[model samples]
Structures are given as structure tokens and as C-alpha cells.
Target: MAMIDLTRGLRSHPVRPPASGIARRRSFWERIHLDPWLLGMLLLLMLAGLVVLYSASGQHLQVPIAQGVRFGVALTVMLVLAQFTPATFQRWAFPAYLAGVLMLVAVELIGDMGMGAQRWLVIPGVIRFQPSELMKLAMPMMVASYLCRRELPPRVRDLAVCGLLIGLPVVLIAKQPDLGTSLLVATAGVFVVLLAGLTWRFIAILALLATAALPLLWMNLHNYQRQRVLTFLDPNSDPLGSGWNIIQSTTAIGSGGLLGKGWLQGTQSQLEFLPERHTDFIVAVLGEEFGLVGMLAFLMLYLVIVMRGIVMAGGAQNTFGRLLAGSIILTFFIYVFVNVGMVSGILPVVGVPLPLVSFGGTSSVTLMAGFGILMAIHTHRRLLPR
Candidate 1:
């Protein structure tokens, strides 16, 4: 009876051959279509950004038609980026980081000057773009990938190497005088390290070392940089010059009260009392127009998005998946915090843009790229179910 049962099982079916060429490629496409929530967020953010951009760009755009065009371009780029998988990104991670660093190196050498900083690269009739923006994503991926191979709870030596990798681009970016982005990249790298189970001892040591470096870093600051630090301590000291932005932003925020001045009718924004209304200070616009209720809702959206990323990272099947998702999410938190801090009087003005709310083609596209990677990690994590 056992022999007859074994024969029947063996004869039941024959295994098929592996997929090859076009058939294999078709299977990949089918899987991506099965999951479109990733694409959904990109669409949502793009639409929201478009509305905010038009409202923010009102001063500059008489008709605001160009704002729509920019969003259209950004949306197309985001959709194209969404199609890529984490594995596809893994293959190109090192090369992309290398290229990004080289571009920064080139920017130091022959880049165009802008806003008193040498950070833009212009190619003939094409366009100008910031290399540092690429670092926003590349630095995290490169550092996380390097440390992912190590055993959990990395050693001091391992952390030192990681710091060096992080510091190189950060130093270059700071040299460009773009302190905001430099800080963001560092935050992203450090978040990945912390998530990898860094001990409190290492965290304490890092705090001490950072404190020790303050004087040396202080000497390296540009004059404007020095002014920002001073203004942060006492915006009242220079209420009309270096501190004008913060003071005005504060008034706009305070005047909002409970319900705010109403949308597009913000006296500060309409009367042009607020500086950078559409960009770094958009929070002020939201606060002035929509009040605390709007601010709370916005905060909740950020919280939900960040928590979702944490969930995805925790559930990731492997080290790379976990690190990638965690780093992106934390960097996003930095963007929100820094932007809000700058508008408020808490943090120094470092020129960090409010994530989806601020206006800029490069930033919007870069943010979408990071979000796409989060999708990749989340989707892949579910497949492995770790």
C-alpha cells in the first residue's frame, strides 16, 4: 500500500521549467501592478503640492499657470521613479553615491554660483540641478548598505567608519554654505546607525565629541552662518535685519489665534509682511490661514506617514530592507522638524524646506524619489514576510 501511494504521488504531476527572457520580464510587470498603494501616495502628495505651490507662488505667478506645469513635470518623474524596485536600486546604489560625490566634487571645482553659494550645475540648454539633493537619498543608502552587513549593535570602530563616510559629503555641503541639506544628510545616516541597535554609551560618546568639535566648527562658519546662530539666540537683537524673518514669522503664527486669518487672506502673507511665504515659511502661511486646527492635521499626516515607515522597516525581511526604510522615514521627520523649527524661534535658520508643502522642482522630485524607495522596501518586505 505504501509503494502504491508513493507511485501515485510521483505520477500526479510534473514540475514546469523556469521562466526565461520575455516570460520572466512579464511576471515582474504583473507583480508591480498588483500593488499600487505606493503610487497612490505619490499622486496624493503631488496634487497637494500643486495646490500649495499655486497658493504659495501667488506673489510671483500672476496667472499661476507655470505652477501647474511644474507639478505636471514632477508627477511624471515621480511615476517613472515608482516603477523601480528596491533590488534595482540596490544594484545602482554604490554607483549613484559615487556619481553624487563626484558631482559635489565637480561643483566645488567648476559649478555655477547662486545665492552666494556654489551648488548648482548647469548643462548648456538642459537645466540646473543640485548635487546635494541627490545626497539626501544617496548618503543614507550608501551608509546603511555598508553597515547592514555588520552584526547587530555595531562596534565603536564600525561607527567611526560610518561617521567618516557621512562626514565627507556633509563637510562638502557645509562648505557650499548649504547647512540645511548637510544637516539633513547627517540626520539620515545617524538614524540608520541608531536603528541598527547603537548603544547609549556610543550615543553619549557622540554627544561629547560633537560638543568638543563646536569651537573648531565655529571657526569654519561663514559670516552669515555666524549671524544665524546669533539671531537664533536673540532674534530681538536684530529685529530688522538678520532676525526679521523669524520675528515676522512669529507674529504671523501668533496672530492666527485659534481659527486663523483665513486662506489666501493671511494679512501677513497678503500684506507681504512675512518673508519666504511659499518656501521655508509655508508653515506660517498654514498657521495664519488655517490656524492650530490645520497645523494639528498636518502634524497628524506626518505622524501617520512616519509611523507607517517604521512599521515597514520593523517588518522588513533583511538588514538592507530595514535600514533603507528606517533611514528614509527618519530623514523625513528631520525635514518636518527643521522646517517647523526654523519658522518658529527654536532652531537657527538653515534653509530647510517644508517637505511637500514648500515650492521647488528639485526638492519635490527628490522627495518623491525617497517616497518611492519606501514603497519598494515596504512591498518587498511583505513578500518575504519577515
Candidate 2:
């Protein structure tokens, strides 16, 4: 009767259809909405990363095959994670944050150190993963859960608590001597705080304090870390030593000219002249082989992902969902920005991979897991609890 009244005389028109069992079945499936465009952008980036990895690896069989296997595994992980909602995530956020912190502490006590950093926990007959990677998701979840119960802007005391939460992980990661991951995690946490409407004055003060501490930070940094900062200022100062990576990267990028040197034909990569060809410096390989056009396409894909994330954040119905979505988006931006900045010689080389493109299973899997959480957040934002 209500439907008849709603439709009024239109119900008598030919457009009206009879409700049947088949219609009900169709409705059920139609109600289950998925964001295909965002998912497509994600898949495209991963594919590009895989293709680039194949190109960048000097020993194609060793790096490319392992990367392909890991990419498949990461896809499975992403699928599993995509099934859960943000509220389900909220229940475990604190525990996940605590566990991640404990793992960081454990690394200091009993971790397998490699390349001057105790960043991985190698379990027998299992995966060797970085605990710091978990912070990419957990930190945002932890911060979002805290900020959701408050007003738009938080109080000073609330800000202090946020600072402490951010500081603990940053200090632990930095002590791992992994300055890059630590910076990314710090940015992830702080991004949520800023999105929660922290005051402009506080942000200004924070920047000023960071600048003020640079001299002090410089004094305490490890020699190599310090060298990176100085080299960033002027790569030519030590072109054959600490500055070699950036110089090669810039030269490769410049030598690509308008189009490129062609696939599998980069002199810098093929001749074994470029350092870290398949990892931190992979972008240089890409620049040399695919030129500015390919670089711009890559950036466009990244921009699509970023914009889609912002849409998810805006579409979110609750504070936690909004903040979590925004945090992930911001963290993604930092990853791209740092990689490009370092490769372009504007920032120091601090060992950050170019998202899915680098030949690192651990990082690739972790990033996919984070994206899965984002999908879950976005998909369940407006759904009613069954």
C-alpha cells in the first residue's frame, strides 16, 4: 500500500514490474557494492611495479621470479584482509599497535641484524618480516580510534598523548637505524592528527622545533646517515663515494632524453654501473628505459590511487573511518614523494623502495595488506550491521 501510494498513478504504467524470486536474487547481489575503479588503479600500479621489477633486475631470474611469486602471495593477503570492516579493525587496533611495538623492542633484544639495522624477525620455516611495516596500518588505526570520540579538534593533552603514541614507534624505528621507515610511520600518524583538525599554530611550532633540532640531530646521526644529508645538499662534493647513487640516478634520468633508451637496454642498468638497480634505485632504471612519458604515467596512476583514497575518506560515515582512510592516503603520498625526491637528487638516499616496484617481498606484502585494510574501510563505511 505504501509503495502504491509512493508510485501513485505511475504504478499503472508499463514501467512497473512484478516483484519475483529472481528479482530478489538480483537485488541481493546488487546490494554488495565494490569500488572497482580504486581496485583497478591498485592492480595497475602493482602490474607496473612487476613489469618494472622485471626490467630493473640485472639478474632477471633471481629478482624477477621471486618478485612475481611474492606479488601473487601479496594478492592473496590483500584479498583476505579486504573482507573485514573498520570496526572489526578497531577491536584489535590497540593490540596490534602494542604487538608491533613489542616486536620493535624484541628486534633490539634478539633480531637478525642486516646492513646495520635490526629490522626483521626471522622465524624458522616461516616469513622474515619487518615489524616496523605493521605500523603502516596499526599506527593509523590506533590514532583514528583515539581521535574519533573527540570533537573535530583535539585538546592540548590529547595532542600530547598523540605525540607520545607517534614518538614511541618513531624512536624504535630510528634506533633500528631505518630512518626511512621511521619517517614514513611518523608521517602516517601525524597525518591523521592533522586531519583531525589540529591547530595551525601547533603545526607551525612543530615545524620550528624540528628545524631547531636539526643541528642537534646532525651531531648524533650515524656517519653514513650524516653523509647522505650532506650529499643531498651537493652531490658533486663526493661524486665517487656517498654521492655516487644520486649522481648515477640523475645521469640516467637525464640520458633518457625524450623517449628512452628502450626496454632492457639501459646502459646504466644493463652495464652494471647503477647501484641497487632492483631496489631503492629502481626508479633510475625506469627513467633510463622509459623516459619522462612513462614516469608521468606512473605518477598519474599514483594520483588516481590518492584521489580515490580521498573520496573514500570523504564518503566515510564515521570519524574513525574518515581518519583511517585519510591517514593511509597521506602515508602513500610520502612513499612516492620520498622515492621521487631522493631519485631526483633533491633529498638524501635513505633506502626507501618505490612502492610495489622494488624487489622486496616483505615490503610488497605489507603494502598490499595496508591497501586491503583501506578497501575494507571504504567498502563497509555505509553498511548497516547484520
Best by TM-score: 2
lDDT of 2: 0.84
- The list of candidate 1 runs beyond 4 A from truth reads 1-30, 33-46, 59-67, 382-386
lDDT of each: 0.78, 0.84
> Which has the greatest lDDT?
2
Q: Write the per-residue lDDT of candidate 2 for residues 265-287, one digit (tens) a residue.
A: 89988887889988999889889
lDDT at 251, model 2: 94
TM-score of 2: 0.91
lDDT tens readout by residue for model 1, 150-177: 8788887888888888899999888887
For every candidate structure, what is the RMSD over all alpha carbons to the true structure, in angstroms?
A: 5.9, 3.7
TM-score of each: 0.87, 0.91
**What's model 1's TM-score?**
0.87
For model 1, the local distance difference test gives 0.78
Q: CA shift at 232, candidate 2, in angstroms? A: 0.8
Clashing residue pairs in candidate 2 (N, C-alpha, C atoms within 3 angstroms): none
